[model samples]
Target chain A: MKLKELAHSRTGDKGNISNVSLIVYHLEDYERLRQAVTAERVKNHFKDIVKGEVIRYELPKMGAMNFVMQEALGGGVTRSLSLDRHGKSLSSYLLEMEISLES
Target chain B: MKAIRIGGGAGYAGDRIEPALDLMEKGNLDYIIFECLAERTIALAQKEKQKNPSKGYNPLLEYRMEKVLPLCVSKGCKVITNMGAANPVGAARAVKEMALKMGLQNLKIAAVTGDDVFLNIEQYLDSTIMETGKPLRERYPDIISANAYIGAEGIARALKEGAHIIITGRASDPSLTVAPLIHEFGWEWTDYERLGQATAAGHLLECGAQVTGGYFAEPGYKDVPELWNAGFPISEFSENGDFTVSKLDEAGGLISKATVKEQLLYEIHDPENYLTPDVVADFSQATVEEISANNIIIKGISGKQKSSYYKTSVGYQDGYIVEAEISYGGSGCMNRARLAEEIVRKRIAYTDLSYEELQTDFIGTSSLYGEQTSTNLIPEVRLRVAARCEERKEAMAIGQEVEALYTNGPAGGGGVRVHVEEVISIASILIPEANVRVDVVFEEL
Candidate 1:
């Protein structure tokens, strides 16, 4: 399954950090999913948009990973959490990455 | 088969050695486990590893081991720990050297690695996306760390090999205990229900005495004895998948339903679906009641079939970051931080500068938002703002703007302390067990 569909939504703060708490039915698949995506690769993929710093944290036990795309959130404390003027969540945008591995 | 005995240990850092040692001594336990990783702690470990790869793995772990391992070795006990950070092999070698120094050459120590999948990061990025079935490069690039949180089986293998000490880099918290059980019981991988119960026991004791009144202790704190040093949780598992959670007698902490409940809730999501490599355990069927002082028996935990994946805890060197705490003074002490955040945001917008992340904090201020829709008070707020970005220049720009806000904003320059920034882009990855395999070999002293 895709991260967006599994996690529902994601949130990225000014630090280029994105967090999505999710549930995976099969516990065995946790590690495979993690190996498929990496923080550096995630940052490099968005190197243009996420020009500052990029970090990722994984809670394998919980089957979750958090990506911190530093400075990607428009100076952080001043910008809005909403995706647009209509206050749409940015989780969908963040989950747009089509990544998979041998899970 | 004989009942399996397991204990889980965790501390604020690595200073809780006395109680840990005491518990081993008093309980005459078979296995002792410890967990010592947080986000910041991982970052710190990574830095230390970069400087001296041999000197990471939570500094306190080596010190504590130096103090207790000899005694543990003399008593013919085994220890399994995740103290092996970026340098599991290095840490294991250190222990071997320590053993040599003590003239105890029979220490048959083993270190389990290969779970760190960082080497395969490029492969992952270059692979296809699961949902869209598109090439990964078509979407994202540059992943940080990719590691597998191997199950207890690796540690169990070390135990089976007759190693008195085992060091691993990132195994599940509950896996510590499950490893011993798997080693002892000769359980099959497909026996998910049995492994699930073992995992539950480890989870209960993973936080040490936290399940026994460390963090969640209340008014009974004064009455509790041996406050100076407390005992971690140990379990006695039977072949039937039943286990009792308890601590050594005369130890400082108290084990009861309240304490166990607190630790159960620690780092958990749905109680109904507590996930593990072996099986998904449902805490709903479990009950914690005080069997005696510093002891709570865990009963009736049902387990389901195992999952297909092993959780991966991969970390990578994304870039460097600097943190500075700017104090806001007087009525708007918090506002000063907020205003600084605003200024930095505006400045970054104007510049081509970008940061991986930046974080700011108002040290002494309110941390909560109003619970109700409209609750009124002359609220005193302190903004603890921080951000992480990839571009060091952007981070510097954000830092400069935050500092500049103090010159013209409320309570100008009351106090500011810039915390050192380091490479903070270690990320976690999840992979299927079928994809990554565990390899173990015996090493002589």
Candidate 2:
């Protein structure tokens, strides 16, 4: 799977918290990943789980991707455990998704 | 709108006073903290304490503080530091000279002391031992410098006294800023949760943005930018002990989980029982995130109980050491370096002299050529021999004998430059928490 396609497949579950970011090791591969995974495709990946919109942000220098999956969880921060106890659940939730480099 | 609380650049290792000053000038910072101590510094402090009661202070600290304190006063930015190596009084006095130079009258400089145990060494050593719960035997005062690592309250007191620069003795590195939080917010010391948060914040930045990719940085060293002049870390602790770690600007440096993770492991082995004079912080209880550019928000640094003892740094005159580099110039010049090490090792071993640390390195002849006297003929090799012994007499004896190797040994060595033998002691001291205290006093020049 292409790294970008892999990124798309992994970010499917996050609902409205559409922005998914990655710290990529390879520079050219990051560019390829960015080019393959467009904002619409990223939103489409999370279409089933997300309730609202999906926005993607890129930090080109650091090879990082930020995905804003809207309504990813049930409610906003007040109703969520996003900031509690070092955000372990969030890290765990994020860790579950896997991505592979493009052939 | 709330009063703007922005000022001072962070993580400045060298004498680069511009970044922090520029930030203070532009951002209007409320505080400026500087860290400039390393492993060798402790040894230097021990040397000073031997010379005078207030000799633990670093002269560089005074030079730096002299520059910053006046600026802080002019801009109302308070300063705190652990520059009080041995003599807080002397450190304060040095700053007072700076204040006088700046013509800043009414510089209320509050000096925090009493952390030193040099005078009371015999008393503590005789009274009790933590391990055996008995008196330290014979109490042969081998101590060079003994000081308790103090917290930030003393700086808080000095701040309260309206002193601009709070010079302290050996203090928890984080306590420099933590005291300010407590003082400004009127937070109690027993506010363990908040204190823990503050301490963790200090730890994260105490080494100046090691948490944000200054040291122990992963990935390629190329991408890390502005590292030559990287900014220090500034933390904002909330009432609930939740804080954000950020630098002065959107400077380039990694602040992701990896960067934060590496820093979290620095000087910390047990996440559960991270000890400081102020509090024992649990890194496990906290979560970290690369929230934004050059910003790492550290949350939920929780600890149920505070620590019982403050980690103390004590040093004594371990001994003297000398090093001499002699070139192997004779027929077997190439092999002389190797021959020299073996000769020194044999002599010391034969004499049954116990040295603390001794090492010999062969220079000029590249080891890339492979170890042992390379048959790939080289012009000459420099046998650089260095050794440290517990006793000066013993170290000197060993030094006197190394020169004899050329005459007695198998040959090919000459041009020996015997470096001067100076009095050096391996100084180490640690004082318990109960003994050390910190106080800050602001004085006018």
Candidate 3:
């Protein structure tokens, strides 16, 4: 199964850093999300775009996790040569990450 | 027992004004905040100010004020905005003049200034830029604008002085909401806990409709009804710091736990230490509950003392960005687009265009993800070529190469479009709060 089945996400950018928040549809799925979506996994998932380190912050009460990817916007929006300078589409790309449902 | 209703009006410089008008007319709000300044908006406005002395503020200031002021005057609701961009005093004067013309009397408009620190930028040349990890002196010559993110103090002062309309430049977005709350509730600057909660409310409301289903529509997965006419957010905040995020009853959007939770973490990196000029708000423990239809209460937010330094945004003239796009459709479109991309790349290399960076993207297949993810044959694809070059003439070659492909290279290539724009890139630096002297100048009509 894909992560999109269990959660939805939103992408926000500040300079070259892009932060994508993944929130579970149900609170019970939060623990499974935390176990599956590791910072290493996220960094590896966006290895093509992100050049710097990836830091993840967990909010168990809110059933969400925020992944902060540095050097992700190709040197920020104002200077980036990419079509989507802000990398707003990154959230959807993150949602496409495959998640193993057999646990 | 006292609570103030604050409406988030305009989110950005180009945000729609109708929803704000709807809020003013129907929401019955005490204060309406139009948070318009973006990271690079002030820098662009500074360039506009270089050409015209009195035209540095938001272009829609008059258009918005003309509609909002009359309603505010009649309804007795105050207005707050960072629409001033690069010129708060000029913006205030313009609003005063417009109010006079509209026969609106007894209006006290305040313009908060001193955010622009370009004249004294030399003093901070030795400081290290937060983003690039280099001294500001490296980009000193190219620096076009430098403005500190001023806090809620100046805005609260303006509100306390009974300024019906307040205009500011580069004030932190959340401070727009926090300022009014401080004035009405008389919250102390040292009250980090309340300030944190208020800042959370401001952050949720800062993006206008983002909290009210504007950005969260995924059809069957996460469906938001009437998103086209989504109402702007309104916060019914109390003195104790907790607030309820709601919209007008007749407005077209849902205020559910999901919408509120998504917005809570938007653009936030460290949930525990979300820094603003006013306070370092902590939203890590924040939770949302839907008590009624269109009303979600947010709680468990706190804050720490603010940092001694203010985060400043420095805009510099980076270079020129040239972008060109040509679409190919019908049979064999993918191959034609790929061939067009290759041709443009070879043409730029052959012409020896001096550029800092360049990229080619097939819009349908690999523009966003940078690789072909799907195996299905694409019927139509757009070839986009973009480059950043030091010289304007050099930047134009990238677009020219793409345009040439319409006749010279690709079959079925159509809708060729080219754009050349100057890049005003932004860098961040920290300035001592003492150096940024904020003052509010009031103009009466």
Candidate 4:
């Protein structure tokens, strides 16, 4: 199943740093999210574009995780030639990640 | 005690005004705030001010004031904004003039100035840019605006001085909302916990309708109730830093846990170290409680003392940018857009004109996500070629060459359009907070 089935994400960009927050629909799904959406997985998933380190911060109480990607955005919003300078659609793109359930 | 209601009237400079006006008219708001100014806008406004002394404020100030101020005055709802842009004093005078024209009596407007540090850019000449690490002197020749993000004290002082409308320059976006909390609850400026809580509340409301549903909706999985008339966000804040975020009754938007959580993390780099001039807010320990439909209570937000340094957004002229686009349609149009993009690149290369940055992407396809996302070809796509060049001639060629694509081949091209804009790039730097002094002056009709 895609991560979109369990969570929604939001992306924001400042300078070259891109931050994406992944929030699950249910508290029961947080452990699975924590295990699936690891920083290494996210970094490897977007390895071609993300040239810097990927750091994830957990908000277990809120059932959300924030991934901060440094040196992304191709030199930030103002300098980046990308059409979507603000990275508004990155969350939707990240939602395409495949999650395997150990049932 | 009942909490005071404050509404976010405007988010960006050109944000929709009708929803905010609706909030003011029917929501029974004690105050309304507009967080309109950003980093590069101040630089652009500085250029405008240089041309005409009274033209430095946000361009939409007149229209917004005309639509909301009269009713806000009649309803006894005070207004606050950073629409002052490059000139808070000028903006205040303009607001006062508008009130007088509207025949509103005793409308007190205060402009909080002293954010502009253009003359003192010389002192920070050797200071390095926080992001690029380039020395401030490297951008000095082209530097246009240098303003420090101030705290809420100036706004609180204005309210203390009986200001009905408070205008400020380069204040933190959250400061617009947090200032009202300070004035209403009489909280000490040093109260980090309370200030942090209010700052969090402000951040939640600063983007107007975003927290309500405007930016939270998806067609199926995560849906919002009413999007067309998405209601701007309002907060009922109490003295103890407890608040309920709601909107006007029967407004078209959903205020659920999901929406609030999305907004909570909006632009937040770190939940524990959200820095502002007033305080370093920590939202990790905060809890969001949905009291009812469209009424979400947020509490337990805390923060540490503010740092001694103030963050400054230094805007400089980064040359010019040109974007030109032409679409391809009908069968195999995707191939045509790509072919057109290739032609554009060859033309730019043939001209022997170098650019600071150049990119040619096929729109209606994978423009930003690159080829990684868009694996299939579409029926129609637009070829967009853009360049950042130091010289106007080079920038002009970026579009001119694209226009020539119509005659140069890649058939079925239409809707050819080109745009050339002067670029203003911003750099962040930290300066001694003590040097940035905020003073308020009153302008009354």
- Interface RMSD of the predictions, in order shown? 12.5, 22.4, 0.9, 1.2
Tens-digit per-residue lDDT, B203-243, candidate 4: 98898888998788999987888789889999899877798
Ranking by DockQ: 3, 4, 1, 2
The CA root-mean-square deviation of candidate 1, after full C-alpha superposition on the true structure, stands at: 11.6
Ordered list by lDDT, greatest first: 3, 4, 1, 2
Task: Compute DockQ for each candidate against the true complex.
Answer: 0.03, 0.02, 0.83, 0.68
Clashing pairs in 4: none
lDDT of 3 by residue, A1-100 (tens): 9999999899998999999999999999999889999999999999889999999999988999999999999999889989899898999999999989
Model 4 chain B: worst 10 consecutive residues (lDDT sum)? B368-377
True-contact fraction in model 3 equals 0.78
The sequence of per-residue lDDT tens digits that candidate 3 reaches over residues B1-445 is: 7999999997789999999999999888999999999999999999999999899999999889889999999988899999999999999999999999999999999999989999999999998987779898988799999999999999999988989999999999999999999889887899999999889999988999999998889989988888989999999998777799999888887788999988999999999999999999999998888889889999999999999999999999998999999999988888888788888888888988788888888888888988836444877788888889999999887888888886798777999999999999999999999998999999997
Clashes (candidate 3): 0
Instruction: Provide the lowest-lDDT 10-residue window in model 1 chain B.
Output: B367-376
Off by over 4 Å in 1: A1-103, B11-15, B38-56, B126-141, B218-228, B317-322, B329-383, B405-407, B426-429
- Candidate 2 residue-wise lDDT, B17-112, digit = tens: 655665555545677676554434554676766677656686677557656766777788777666766667787877887778777766677787
lDDT winner between 2 and 4, please give it. Answer: 4
List ranges where model 2 is wrong by over 4 Å. A1-103, B1-19, B37-43, B46-56, B126-139, B217-222, B250-256, B324-336, B349-384, B390-442
Candidate 4, residue B260: Cα displacement in angstroms equals 0.7
Cα displacement (angstroms), candidate 4, residue B303, comes to 0.7
